[model samples]
Target: MENYIVIIAIISSIILFLSAVIVFVRFYRERTQFKILLGVALIVLLAGSIINVFEHTAILQSAEEFEQILSILFLPIIIFAIYESIIGEQLRTHIKSEQMFKGIFNQTFSFVGLLNSEGRILEANSTACDFIGYDNDEYKGVFFPETRWWKHSAEEMKNLEGAIKQAGQGKTVRYETTNIDKDGKIHYVDFSLKPIHDSRDRLIYLIAEGRDITEIKSTRLELEKHKKNLEDIVEKRTLELKTANEELQLKNETLYEKNTIINEQNAKLVSTLIDLKETQTQLLQAEKMASLGVLTAGVAHEINNPLNYIVGAYEALKQKDTHSGDEEAEMLLDAIKTGVDRVAGIVKSLNQFSRDTPAENEECNIHEIIDDSLVMLHSRLNNKIEIHKNYFKDSFVTFGNVGNFHQVFLNILSNAEQAINEKGKIWIKTTKNDNYLIITITDSGKGIEKDAINKITDPFYTTKDPGEGIGLGLSIVFGIIKEHGGRLEFESEVNKGTTVTVMLPQKGMKHE
Candidate 1:
């Protein structure tokens, strides 16, 4: 029996020592108060186990009372450690996760809300609350179908209730609906309700999402009206042509000449219709560009004020005596300064690009403009595409609107970047030929086809996928070059590469 107790005591001491080592390592890594408490409790248990082993092995015969005291003290310390490390840590993590979710939920652009299994609104994002002029507090715990968004129309309310019911049955429901906003204006919404389930597939809650499609709906309606008008005009023209054909049949002696005249008229009408369509596309592109310019200008202006503040703060921080001789702090401050400078440069480029009014003709350095445009598009290149600049020795300076030249190079460089799929190289070169300065940009990308090369500069002609581009980039580039008394040229081969040449008259030469 004495030998058996000795063996058991040795095994318990071994287990307790291993546990204590693990707890101490965890404390060393995390260095938290809870971990410290846990490590101390583990050490106490390990000490008592060691004392028991010594007493059983006849090494310390009078330590039994001390072992009993240690055993008594171990219980409360372990309880406190368990409570702090497990329960307290889990509670903190839960609160942090909730805060992160709330931030994303409120910051999203779409209308979003959470509904309980019983179809009552539990939480609504800021966008949804503001759209209907109701606070989140006002909408909480209210039946989703009876909320302010659907309260104006009985049919809508009924439809929403049906959607909620379907969602509760584990079905996703999506449809377009109309709702009245806070200002009494009607909005078209693409709405959906999706059921959320627990790990065991039990229904827990529902997610409601809505996106305003009022502009798209209005544009579609306008297009339908125009299509109807065009149909009416075609019908009228057909009837007129039929009447003329009938008259020509009756006057057979003069049939040939009348038929020729009607054919000519028909040809002219078709040509006019084609021109009208081209003009409409151009106008639409112009409107989109105008809106983009306005947005860019506003954003640049907003960012500039904050950027100045950051620069001022960084300067002040660098001069502080507390951070002197600290290499890590100095490196961090340098990084902040570099980041601020980069943002300022981007804002300057945006301001220049957004300028619509033509400035007086100035001496623009060809290389500088190209460099600025590259900075603007650095994000797209992402270091995947290599840029090789082979500028002319003597800086090719020309007289033109600096902003227009910036736009020209920006559009060209952007096209070159988009042409490459994964990895490629872009080479920009400049040289002078007689009274003209020539700039060429070459890209090692999937080149344009022979058929598309000619039409690439035409308005609304694009080879890119839908929604990726509007195909007006080259058209705008062409217009800018022509305005500055320059000509644009393109050379390409399938799967090989493309070279774009831009030739502008040198300074002191007549632009006309």
Candidate 2:
């Protein structure tokens, strides 16, 4: 027994030493408190085993006793260490997983929801709650119904429900729909549905993700309206421009027609003027023939008288029984000679007056012609009509015929005098500039009417009574001025006055 005790003591000391070393190492390593506490328990069991071998005598010296002690002391400690480590690790894992889930839910805008195969709501995230206007807990077991949002028909919802159910058969569906929230606001949502399967491929849950698109839909609608409005405005402006262009084209056509009519009228007026000129020429020739007829008669009478005288004298001389000296015959021949001389002088004067010729072009002083014409018409002027002259200091000479120049002044002055009836005045002026002579005649009469002044020089165009004067005076004046390469202008106002002006190119500066 003693030998056994000593041997047990040595073995117990070795086991306790080993356990202490292990406990020390565990503390230094900063291992689990449970593991360190287990090492301490092992040390206590080894010490108890050594004491038990002595206390129980020879019977306690059996290995079974040592084994029983170790079981009693160390078994529960090992189990406790294992339980503490496993339970603590599992608790930390569960806490970390919950924190991760909260972070993911808060950060994501994606609406997440879980549903059963029958479209019943199982669980939803906060984003899903916000979209449906429900608290996350309140929607955990709600059911989805076949109903449309904002008065749309339910057929669309029914179709979406069928698609979600079909997704349960190992497929996925993505679609868009409109839904009404708890606040009665309609929202457009784009959604994707997916089915979750367990290890055995059995349908477990349906997961759906959604994105809101209401603002996008509204923007599209507004853009469409603005596009339509722009089209309408452009169409209206196009119509207006078309109408304006049509009006301008019509005005252009009317102007072209008016121009054509005016041109035709101008041609007809020119032809009529030519006919009038020919008629005036014929009338002038007729006047000349009438004068020639009278002159011819007078010449025949004068010639006959001279011949009769000479013939009678000869007959008397022939019948006489001659005396060598015939004084009576000589006296009769002298009378016959006197009659012939008289007839010849009359014939010469008639020939001079009746001669027909064109105006002879020459350098002439119009002022001198004006003076001569005034002297000729001095007796015709009435006392009531005053005459004034404004002749320039420079001489007024032009290239023209003297007879024709005289005729022009005479016609104008006579017309002026006739225009002034009672208590009126006539003004005459002559000036030279730019190698041209300007002559002006003004009459303060019951002036020419506005309608008649433009036609005042046309042949047969006169304001006088039918026979008071032939209308040839102004016409003759116009012809002479035209032949001298001059232009005539007249200005008048009714009941105020009339002015006639003539412009003639200076001598050596004449142009046709």
Candidate 3:
């Protein structure tokens, strides 16, 4: 029996020590007052368990009493923390709802009041209380017509009573009436009374809403006075126009006869202009082609010289079969030659691609293309960014080189993915504005600084690492947009996000 008690005491101390360590670690991270109190209580319990393992009667009894004191002090706090952790969000939501209701009820400029169906004022907003110059408590449970907001006259009060009665019967009543403020000032107000029903459709309260319309009433009266003055001026203008019309009619006949001769002469000029325009168009086309050929040749000649250098280096290495060469050197020579040849091939291919007819356009939906772009980047979006798509249902179709459009979307989405560090959001909105289709791609990522934003689309300018990008993506997108007669723009804030907006015409540009 002594051995068993010792073993049980050891097990208890182990469990209490573990619990104390966990609580201390939690307090270290959180640094909350409740955690502080809870940590102290756990330490006391752990101390009591350790003392019990020794079997010292005097110390053990004192430790147990101290443990009881700590429990009494901290149990309520630990229980409160547990409750908060479980349902804190629900409590926060309820508090927010109360704040919103109070803001709308107390902070509005319009005079608003709630009344019992018998027309007794139950509550009034601050605006109503201030407007009538009465305390909120002063107006409680008072009849609406008898309140200070209404006039002192019997007839006015009777009319207000009638409106209130009508509102109590589920009918809305509205009228322009004279209301007396606290200082015996009369003001005209557009007042409305309506009945409010409970969830069960039982009439509960009458709502009184009002707007002061004294200035509007004054403006209407002024306009009524100006009506005759405007009519007199209009009559005078009509008499003058009548005399002018008679004289103008004779002059118009003379001018019309002269215009007939001019029209015949203009027809010959217009025909001559059309022929001249066609001739000019042909000459311009010829000039454009010649300039394009010269430019392409110059670019190819300049870039292809390095290609020959690499090829010559490889050939020299190959011919020196007797010379001993390191394997790394030989392998590098071969790689350089291969890379140069690919460059030469791409240059030649570009010249050919320009000469060949552009790929045929197809009717593609803008939203569908966006969807495809998102699919291609799903791996990146899986854990990092949430996609929000806002697109209309009806197909927004346009004649497009679908491959080119696909590249454009992919480039933009990839840039967004690279820009964000970790978790963020991307918002893509598509809408047709006037005759153009507008697509906006916005991301919550580290944004381009203002100085760098203008330089982003420039050739060979980049903010990416050496192996990550060569900086030609945005420039290519700019060219693609220009070919389609569209516009591209960017809005950004540092550490917030960037929004790329592209506007393309409904009808795509003609292929060059």
Candidate 4:
């Protein structure tokens, strides 16, 4: 039993010595008061264990009294080490955490304050103190609702007092209210009171916070005012529109009746105007033919007598030139004959135009009629205008009023001649399409205006200078072509030129 006790004490001494060395090493590195206290306690324990081992093994029998004294000191030193390593460290950590929480609570931006359950102001952060122009100590013990922040407004104080009472009952209260700063300026505040509870769920403190909302409140009020104004304007305009609509409906009813009566009268007037225009056109044609016939007959009679004498003289000169064998005299005689023939041709064309006989089914050679018209207008087209004639290879014969067709070609060729200002061109093309003879006359003159082309064939609608033309020329042409079961179309462009197309039914074909 003694050996077993001595061996166990020796192992215990070794463990204590290792524990003491580790404690001393930690004390040296940390240099803390607790570490040094633990090291001293461990060293005392290790010394006691060594003395016990010496006594038990008889290695130091004279130290038996010292081992008993060390054994008495062992328990107190072990207790001291446990206290310094655990309990002391926990207490220091708690103190540091409390200091950090206080720093965060005071330095926040908003108005932050703490109140006891009795509604007394326990603590106010620096922001709250500076805003109300009060020192922290001055308002520390005052009732929260009666503090400097609420001194300017009695109503705000009553409201805050109620909120505090609610918060003390463990309820959170939030509201928008006004507060006065130190400079007496009123500021809108979003205020709240929140209750803090203990671990037992008992209300302990109230946390009061406020955020400035003066600018936000002002903007909201302005928006509401503008919205009200807009509604008023819209209501007024809607009423005005409704009244105007009712008046318009009444006017429309009245106008509808008047329009019915006016339209009846207008229909009668239009028919009368059309009949009068037709009568006027017939009278004009009759008078023009009468004058032309009389003029042509008188002119032909006066010229034919002299023309017969020249023809007799030319025949006698031709016989004399043949006997003398003179080429120059023969040429002179030929020239005289040519002049006489040309004059006779002009008289024949004028006679044709002057004829009042209307033969609606006369077989007319369109090429011959066009050639006669060109002959009549030779003086006007001699030097100033170029004439291009594209005749069909086959004969283009159409059944129409022979005299009327002669007058049609004459008036068209005359118009073409007069349209040329200084130097221009006229193209006369004749072609046979299906059972119709198509005649197209194009002129490179100053083109007619777009607005005037449609009205050109209307009676008395002239673009000529006064006393130059009666404007009945094209109207008469339109009438003659219509009478022969034909169509007339005019195409013109400003500053470009004009093209007139005439379509007349051929012989043995009916009008389409």
Candidate 5:
């Protein structure tokens, strides 16, 4: 039994040594008193075990004695651990509270200054330094009233002195004060000062804060001036209105006679406007008929050529000997059908161009309108003009009476054809620019002189020999483009060419 006791003591001593080593490691890592106490307890147990096993056995041989010894050592260690925990908690709380105070003080947008009880600045935050245009070193230990911020206005400085005195008495004071900056520029601030006291009820410092309110001050003054002006205007307008009422009552009979005259004049004016509108529309119709009249010879030629082709093809086929698997008949029929379709297209274009009533406004591609106009002028320009088309592939969409667009293109193109007495090239370019479609028609022709360019689109103004053109074509075009919220501009130099630019807005577009 004594030998067994020795072996148990040796095992117990090993556990105590390991526990002491772990406790000391924790003590070094945590720097806590609890770990130190745990380390000392483990070491004391390890020493008791070693002495029982190697030196003496009677004292630590019993479990009860070992437990009693551990209890005696652990009581004081527990108390120390509790005490150390409380102190650590207090230190952590103090650190967090200081961080919070510093965050609020430095990060606030308002100017904040910590002033000693004597109203001298002890510390100024970044905002305060920036606002005053001074470094921290410059303002430290400087009296609030002695700073450069109050240099411009004595009244503002007086107000500041009163606030400081109130704050020094442990009373909070708030007032507006004008502050000057490094450049002596005046600014208003919503200024406030409050007394801070220590736990012993002694004044520690004064916290001065100010938010910029210069714009607010200016606005208030403007509002007051406006109010005064409005009151004066109301009084003056009341007097004028009272006098005018009396005059109005006296002139009732004269006003009644004048109204009667005005009504009659208005009726005549409205009638004249209606007549003018009808005359204007009639002139447009007459111009379309005149265009058709010019195309009559071309239309006849267009129709006759196709008809003659069909006749010649038909006669040639009839005379040919019929044979099985002959390609001759099929080829002649295809030629005849093509010619027939060409004739049919010319007639259809003529019918569309000769509409008796104006077409309603519709969404249309300007390129399609240009194509139809070119189709109408086809016979006239077939071999004479080389047409260069640079049209927008996506198409420029605009809202307007499609017929009016047709008329506009027809008129411009007709002028172009006439301008070029011989063979030439005509370039038609369509492009987009910021809610507008720009169409540029450039014709290599005999351009008008600078003096005549101004009068080109004028009514009844013709550069053509008197009978050659009535000169209403471009005038009508100008009126149409203008009514569509668009403009027509011409750039020309004699014998070089003329470029007619048309700008049409794409928004809120409709026929007028």
Candidate 6:
């Protein structure tokens, strides 16, 4: 029996130690004031177990009194210590909660109230009292269903009754409503309702948190006004841009009209200039004719006397004896006939020059004209210079003034001949392809420089020794060809050669 008791005591002692160890471990981890009190209890229990071990029993002769002393002394100490810490923590928590509630409640302009399930006012923050114009003590048991907040409309009373019923049934209800204050000014409030339940899961009260939305409504109106003002500004700017665009278009149209007028004037001026050049060319040709006429008249008078004497002498030989009219007399008559024919030809050429009508228009071979011009220049040409005639097999003919065309060929040929200063060749080539008659007069002469080529065809533009050329030849040719509705093309290389091509539309051809 003693051994069993001892075993039971040891087991009880181990259980107590284990309990103390668990408490100490938990206390050490938590490190709260309550944990400090629990550590003291564990120490006292540990001393009690050690004393019991020496005594071999939990009770001694004074065991009851000792237990009573420990209970009276240590139990109160442990209880008092833990109780003080719990009270302090709970008090601090309650004070902080109250302070936070007061801070939030003061800053808010909304109403807040707490009601019990009986619909009686249980608690009311300051804003609630201010909104309802009542003190906390004045509405402690006042049911909100009977209050003035619900007195305005039956619908409001029904909504309030529904919210109370839902909260009593342990449900949260949230909605918006209007309420008139003590001053009879209606206010809109958005209120959120939360149900508070007891430990038994029965709803005991409902927390109503209300927020005033008057400022939000005012802000919405201001934003609408600003939007209207911005729209007006955009409309005004759009109108301004439209006006500016119209002005720019008007200016552009005006500028285009002025430009068109100027272009028309320029065209008329160019036509007048071409006409003037043609008139000037005609006058120059007339002057050359007058000079040639004076020269031809003097030569004709001198040749006529010589021709009359030769005819007289040939007749006298014929009238003499038939025997005397031998081989010598026959040769004299032939000589006289040749002299008379030559004089007649010179007179015909002189009469052709004196005629002042416009050049005769006809279809003529360009190659034949070039050959005739070469024949006239053959005696005067430099002996060292070569001549190349690459005439087309088929004749190139155009409907134009033949005299004018001939003059164009003569002027260009004369210019090419003068350009050659040393032993060089003159190349004349005629080509007919498509609708164009291309006549190229090339000279192996000092070619035009780059800077001078642009203005080479301009009137008075010349690169020749004084008294060798008057520079009017090419200008006259340029005018004549232009009057025939043709163009003169020039291509040259410095110190190499120069080529002048006159392109005219072929006969019987018309522009499509």
Best by the lDDT measure: 1
- What candidate 2 gets wrong by more than 4 Å, as runs, is 1-67, 79-95, 130-136, 146-157, 230-512
Clash count for candidate 2 is 0
TM-score of each: 0.45, 0.37, 0.36, 0.48, 0.42, 0.37
Model 3 lDDT tens row, 311-427: 787788778865456787777777877777667665653343223234335665677677766765677888889999889666576665665666577778989999999899999
After superposition on all CA atoms, what RMSD does each candidate show versus the true structure? 28.5, 33.0, 31.1, 19.2, 19.5, 28.5
- Candidate 1: minimum summed lDDT over ten consecutive residues — where? 280-289
Give the Cα lDDT of each candidate. Answer: 0.86, 0.73, 0.76, 0.83, 0.81, 0.73
Candidate 2 at residue 195, lDDT?
Answer: 90
Highest TM-score: give the candidate number. Answer: 4
Error of 2 at 95 (Å): 5.3
Residue range 1-512, candidate 5, lDDT tens digits: 88898899899989888888887887788787657766776776676667678544565445556655765776687677667678766888899999998888888988898999999988887877777688648888888888877878777777788888999999999987777766768888898999999999899999999898989999999999999999999999999999999999879978998998899898898777566555766687777776677575567567777677777777676566773357776786667777777776666566556655444457757887888788889989999999999988775888767767778888899889989998998999999887789999999999989999999887667999978987778888887788778899999999998999998876455435
- Candidate 3 whole-model C-alpha lDDT, 0 to 1: 0.76
Better of 4 and 6 by TM-score: 4
Candidate 2 C-alpha lDDT tens digits along 334-430: 6766765555544443443344456545667777778766755666774667779999887678776675676677778888887777678889998
Model 4, stretches more than 4 Å misplaced?
1-7, 21-39, 54-74, 84-86, 89-93, 169-171, 197-202, 258-512
lDDT of 4 by residue, 1-512 (tens): 98888888878878878887887787788876676766777677778778777877778888878867766776676677688778878888998998887888778878899998888989888888888898648988799989889988899999998998888888999999988899999999999999999999988899999988899999999999999999999999999999999999999999998999999898897787577567754754574665474677789778889999999998887776364767787778889999999999998887766656655657788998898888878889999999999999997898776678877887787777777788999999999888689999999887789999899988767988898787777887887788778989999887678899999988888564
Local accuracy of candidate 1 as per-residue lDDT tens digits, 256-313: 7688889979889778757845565355346446646566778888998888899899
* Angstrom error at residue 463, model 6: 1.6
Which runs in model 6 stand beyond 4 Å of their true positions? 1-278, 290-293, 296-355, 382-384, 510-512
Using alpha carbons, what is the TM-score of model 2? 0.37
For model 4, give the 10-residue run with minimal summed lDDT.
Answer: 282-291
Q: How much is 307 displaced in model 5, in angstroms?
A: 35
